[model samples]
Target chain A: MSIKSIAFIGLGAMGAPMAENLVKRQFRVTGFDMRQEARQALVNAGGHAADSAKAAATGADALVLMVVNAAQARSVLFEAGALEALAPSASVFLMATCPPGEAEAIAAAVEKTGRHLVDAPVSGGIAGARGATLTIMVGATQESFALARPVLDAMGDKVFHVGFKPGQGATVKTVNQLLCGVHIAAAAEALSLAEKAGIDGALLFEIMGGSAASSWMLKDRGPRMLLDDAPIASAVDIFVKDLGIVLDAGRSAKTALPLAAAAHQMFLASSGLGHGARDDSQVVRAYRALNAKPANDP
Target chain B: MSIKSIAFIGLGAMGAPMAENLVKRQFRVTGFDMRQEARQALVNAGGHAADSAKAAATGADALVLMVVNAAQARSVLFEAGALEALAPSASVFLMATCPPGEAEAIAAAVEKTGRHLVDAPVSGGIAGARGATLTIMVGATQESFALARPVLDAMGDKVFHVGFKPGQGATVKTVNQLLCGVHIAAAAEALSLAEKAGIDGALLFEIMGGSAASSWMLKDRGPRMLLDDAPIASAVDIFVKDLGIVLDAGRSAKTALPLAAAAHQMFLASSGLGHGARDDSQVVRAYRALNAKPANDP
Candidate 1:
């Protein structure tokens, strides 16, 4: 199958860059997003901008779903009729992080319409998406994976064929988020302890960054956590959603995830305290609020 | 200030090798521990084995305390009179993870006895201790740090003078433990999630080890977590103690450490389940037990 034209939905921070990469790689990309600015960004990157998911997916050999969650993926594919709009036998790549059960169900539905569903979820954050260095975990039948390989490669540097099962990619991605969400919250908690102890946060970062306690999240998010007012990179609400997906998956699998559950609470507190739109590093604010003392006492 | 003699207390997994490193470096070393085997291990490494902490400290230029906790340090220094046994102006290195307040109190008492305290807490685990590659975070006056530099260099490949205060090393160590403990529990939780989801635990380890969710603890402990019965490298009780020290420090500073508290509970549960003596990686067992069902049901 000679696949060329691609439809990309959800032109957000991660998806926009990924769609841009497809355009740069000379794939005929048609992108759509709810946000006009996001759609405009895609148009600026030399991709055609469609008004809706269905319009973007129409006549395309492949449709990529990079929306926020399973609900959005469902709405776009079913409610918005993107699945029905895609050409018969067109591969649908679900790049969003969703529950494995949800992915399997969606795959079954797509299969009934004579289309292939490639359960491909990605990691490596926004910079990776922009640079086309994202890691993609793909779950699909051999034929579907073969049809989606070039498109996956165009958006990600490392592609792992995790399994032929539909939800395997979501399972792997859930595992990834389980760690990522916990690590981010853990970093926030540690830095909060450092601040409360009056230890120099930057110095502690340098020391721990070189020590056995270090994680990719601590090294990547540690500096942002130190800022008096950090810029929003990834918002706290994202983990609120991601970890929710993680816990749901665990619940579905009859697994108890205490650490992930605790981390979800941390993110929830951050969101509750009005930091949902702020950088996830601001989860430290939740800790600070909890530990707040009389200003004059110290 | 030609520091030729060293007194090392607490010859456990970390201390015995540290003392051995000093001996290998041609320093005159005397080591002591409650365990006969530990003391014999030091003796086998060509270091003098002493009957007590006082015996170890007597006439030494520096005394290194590698005991389990602040209580042990207090017992060795006050109850056992190791402070009175050391020579005047002798530098004492507190190499164990302890509460900062405890270290400050010990430093004050050591100063009253005309001895110096260098709060030098070490990391890099058993392999680092044996290979002389431990990272030592030191808190001391310039004179005391200068006095202990040669001795510190003999035992650790990387040494950072963290601050001038006595408890700064403990503060830095608390920060380290907060991350280390939480990361270990996080790795266990993620691996358990994978196990329950029927994903290959080893494959998930490889994939996540290379992803953004990766950490030193995850990479170091992840493989061990997958084992049916992993060897004891660092025991669960160790984190129980370290994170307890961390939470104690947090309490003293009036900080809220939800993640650390959650991880502490995981370790405590692991210990409560009789895996305290097992490797810390066995914390996954705590997760497994929680998620366990009738074997044939799944």
Candidate 2:
């Protein structure tokens, strides 16, 4: 019941910063990753690096999975035998963005191993994760959320218990991605149109963002779009996966996700044009190529 | 150069309230409309009512056109004889939502008569119009914008001089509408997906709006989407026209507008379903019909 030791899996761009925050907050943290450099990075940051996922889970009060998808989260636990290696009373918090149904299924699998599962999905990007201000959406039993509150509080500024069902967090995250995908595409189109019309894209952004046209996507992605190439913060295929989950969830609900579907195609086109591994803002590259006008040129 | 007399044409929901605001501000306002009741409503509000657009334009230093589209705006000015009646140095502010190219054409026609044209588009819905806090996007030469600044100040709190050309206002407005169209559809899809998953739609709105999924559309349209019969504010076909302009601009620029195109279909379907006159948020109804769970139903 006491939160002392924790295992953080998947030390990538987001995960590494999140794990560092936990260690900074005085938690006994052990990190594990397949990448030797990632493990070394954690070891250099005053935290122990586990030899394996199961080794990290051993004697830990909580195991946090910050992997890419459900497949990796599953492999880290079930396939790697971390479920059997962790303390019987420990909790596993899956913070990866995955399909809602998969989260539910995984929760069932984790519960059968005599441990608690908190389907927690974090938002606000790596910046918020490192700042410990990320918004965490939780879908778990009230008891599980209560037990995980202290640890989650150390990582996120705001935590909402959206529902008692295990998959609801992922469900909300999917919906979030749908909006993000559509808004990003919408912003890119607007900027391109303005630029084509010989209007200043940056000035147009300032005017539109102050108007009813303003969106989180426009505000977040608009400036990044002004740069043709930045480091890949979040990839185009990330939306390809997230919006794919959105469309799939919509299909299951028999709901029509027209904008999300359309945005999905744009990301697909970006991926098709060999920018899949680049930042999601690179979706603008697809439009830029099609329009044949460099945004910075005119 | 005295600014005592003003004429307002095309007294629709927005125009009527706008003219009334001018009257309330103690301006010598004359309102004209094809709809008798629209004019009568202005008269009822203590403003002078003119029988024809030309009569209203005669002797006025400023004329504001709040008509539907470019063709209608042209017809009122030329065919309806308003242009022939205006004073030589008068300023005509076209406050309607029209395309940039059309605005440019209209500006050319207005300037041919030695009159100035201010391409000013207002935002903030009927409530904002009534409250006199609408945001006005104005595009004009320095003299024209200066001539209309006080008038725009009387109508809106935020007056942005987007550019020096008449079409630039329309261009900026089109950009705003593109994001507006995409965000509304995105909000609908996100909310519907959450509702379909047995998650509380209201709670989902609260969570997503507070999270990275947040946007002006989600805040503006999310609650109205929950109403059984959404009150008509802005109709669905409005987005149809707006997105049409957006996509048309994009296509003319050879820019891809996938999100706008997708959002366009939802509005088109809403229009086709006989909900064109309903609130734009009623696009959620399209998702409802597909899901067989009405948005208003808890």
Candidate 3:
């Protein structure tokens, strides 16, 4: 059956606009958040406001968990009775960035209830979320993928069915984070080395951004890296968390990710240096801190 | 005085075409190489071929050293008497990817002899050399830059006067190599983790090549990484050597480049595993060897 209603939990910056986009597509979108303003913002955007996750999922064709973490998703579904409230044989789209192992466990539990689970995770950050241009990676059975396609189309233009395994989409996302985090940290390392030799950071990036040294992260975050304080586009703690997930994925799969592991250390150091809340580009600060010369040196 | 007669050393894969490009631009070009065919290739393209470095440099306004390393450049300029053979107050464009410290030393020695040394290193590889589209990073005084401008423009379209100090251009090139090496190895690590989870490597790179995960190295070397044997665009030992230079530069400046140091190990292992002559993308093999599941484990 087609999805006419979507129960979207976690009405934060990403979820609110995503739920609103579903509502604009003529689907009945009921969104639930602990914050009244968040729920009200979705309501103002023509989505229904729900006081609880269970209320939002009642009779909905699909339930999308966009909450903060796997534990929160679990609380909403099992503890809050959202799973039981969904219509019989309805699909659950877990769109949060969860560990692959956790996603697999969640899938088995969801499948036990005679419902389908679409393992979906996203990239593209706030602007992509607001503009409905997010890149969504899905891991689901062919049946669930068909069921989720039209609804997923409402929120993202770039959607890929990565694999049929329940945790494969999460794996793709974990890998994506691995590349992004490593690239950002590597850019910091490169820029820091150049600055140590007194080459202008701006000029170095201007040359690198057009050369084989370029990365999406370098072109996007490189200018901000030159600044003493760049406004937060994304916090350093996000990569601290994301690369943590990447390492966890590697461990579970018994893979050694030396580059990712080293990159994560820089993010962890940046966070420990109290720049966790600062922009991700501030990871360069960690490099600077580690490599700065002694005051007494010539 | 304007540069007219030019001496080009090391007429190998990159230098042969570079000398030919200078010939096409109407410079009175004379090139020398150890190999007869390399020198003949330049001669066939309308440039003259000299039997020795000193013979090529005799009375030339500019000497372009595109040799393999600092040792070879030193041999050609000092031991081979090319420095003394140059016209009065001539300029030397050292275009090898040498360590920044070595470039500085070479410049000092050249300056002591009443000649200018422009520390110029290039990227874009053999293809860039042939098309004269190389990105040349130069570190020279204003007078040296003015003298080298028209002559350098004949070989590379993107010529950057990175700094006045002789080693700064080499520093930028060192940092550029740092980013490039880390990016290639990071792509391997990311792809290996995805494959460990049974996700498709091509699909993973396709998603990543569009997302923030993308790098010039990933987009260029990623596809070749999936194949069992990819025809060599660049050998793995190239990075093995380049990242070595990067680390040497970092060490000289007292900077701790953890990411670059980690990436160098992977390239080193790939070379140690007897894939040194293989394509650089085969750094993935080091990752594969590290992370492969047991053959006997069912």
Candidate 4:
């Protein structure tokens, strides 16, 4: 179960830094992405850049999928023939958030190819990825977990072996997203209420940051929410996508998620108002717009 | 300007301890409540028991109103003639969560009677009240704030002069409730999702508690939510009341509070399901009930 080489797919904001961390840790890393600049960034970090996913996987002991969703993971592994390109018994780590059933399905497919699959979805955004301080929730068999431990450690400080089944990692991640999305929207609503009430938003943020109402998202995104034009750390549409997965999972489990559903609608409204690519804190803008409407209009 | 005696109204879970703290600090405290037991408790704590709100206010330099809402505060101050009973130039501390406009109206009435109104609303629940560690947000003129500072310090550890306006403390408190109510409901949704996903709820709590998904409410109320019959520290009906005030303030300001509105509905559903008097964590029960419905129904 000795890991020698790794192939990393999807070098986006999160993935590029994660792949960079592994390379800095002296792993022989081959990275691939649709974007030329993303591939070039990895090469600049002293990691090899592959022309295609298959080429990246070739001769690698493990293939890491940091792609956007399950569909992209499927495209990389099956459509791009990355699965066949990997060495025998190679471990595949799915770090991106996806539906539990989708991860399980991908695991089943990877298992059919005589490879191990570790459903290891991660938290702690782009900054965490670069710092190698992400929290990785792993769902895999003991053998697969053993094979992926070093690789997981290289990318995250907190690597939790959540369960011994495929999709369990995704399950934990879905729960995290449910709380994250709701907290962000709630933060926006509180700030918006403060602004509308003519209270100082910054002062309110400071007060609540020390109060029982505090949340990681409230403290993290609250100041950004005050800025009318904050940088896009996480886009509003990410929640639109992540909360969609959450509701889908809730549907599959017959679990109703009213708060998540409500938060999802606010995110959707933000995206609908052309803030999809803006910072998620820009959900406050959507609130501002809603408040700007006449009292009896609704 | 020197404070000598105090009258405290509403000796409930929060008020009784706050009054006890003041009495323990050697303030001549006369407390009154509709319940005889509440008055008896105050009497046992070395504080005088008044037969009525007016009797409590008589000869007192400051009157502390910790009643449930604005209506009750008005009942004690106006209907019960407590304001008239108080000494001239006395200060009235409105320490309950009330509508901003109501506080303004009350402040005007107190001003007409040559009494100062300090709109000082406190956070940190019952335990904080007992421990004298509450955070009090004060809305008062400089003169009135000066008069009430020592009195406020006797009950709360952190007292912020948020603004000079009569309703500003209520405004800050409203924003706090918006976040608190939403966070509590979001915590319930995340825990419920974990329970439905077959993941260990306690483990998820631990993981998320340390992650970016962490929140004060989640860390505080989440363990209680896991219990089938958790103690009623804060009732579901309290959120029902607080969030109602939140939406009321939003309506007054023409502000749209989708998250707060949504959280309010969930609290209402929890109450409608006969958990109104149950602990606020029982909002999870509403989620459980929703999840228990047949899959095809929704």
- Listed in order, each prediction's TM-score against the native is 0.90, 0.89, 0.98, 0.92
Q: Give the whole-model CA lDDT for all candidates, comma-separated.
A: 0.88, 0.86, 0.92, 0.90
Clashing pairs in 4: none
Model 1 steric clash pairs:
none
Provide DockQ values for all models, in the order shown. Answer: 0.70, 0.62, 0.89, 0.71
Residue-by-residue lDDT tens digits, candidate 1, A1-298:
7689999998888998899999998999999998898888888889999998999999889999999888999999999999999988898999998899999999999999999999999999888898999999888999999888989999998898888888988999999999998998888888777666556778888888999889999898889987878988789998899899999998889888888998899899989999899898888778778876446533
Better of 1 and 4 by lDDT: 4
Q: Name the candidate that leads on DockQ.
A: 3
Q: What DockQ does predicted model 2 obtain?
A: 0.62
1 or 4, greater by DockQ: 4
| Local accuracy of candidate 3 as per-residue lDDT tens digits, A240-288 | 9999999998888889999899999999999999999999999999998
True contacts kept of each: 0.82, 0.79, 0.91, 0.81
- CAPRI quality of model 4: medium
Question: lDDT tens digits, residues A1-298, model 4?
Answer: 5888999999998999999989988889999999998999899889999899999999799999999899999999999999999999899999989998899999999999899999999999877898999999999999899889989999999998888888999999999999999999898888777766566788888889999989999999999988878988889999899999999998888787888988898899889999999999898878877766344532
Query: What TM-score would candidate 3 get against the native?
Result: 0.98
Q: Candidate 2 or 4, higher lDDT?
A: 4
Better of 2 and 4 by DockQ: 4
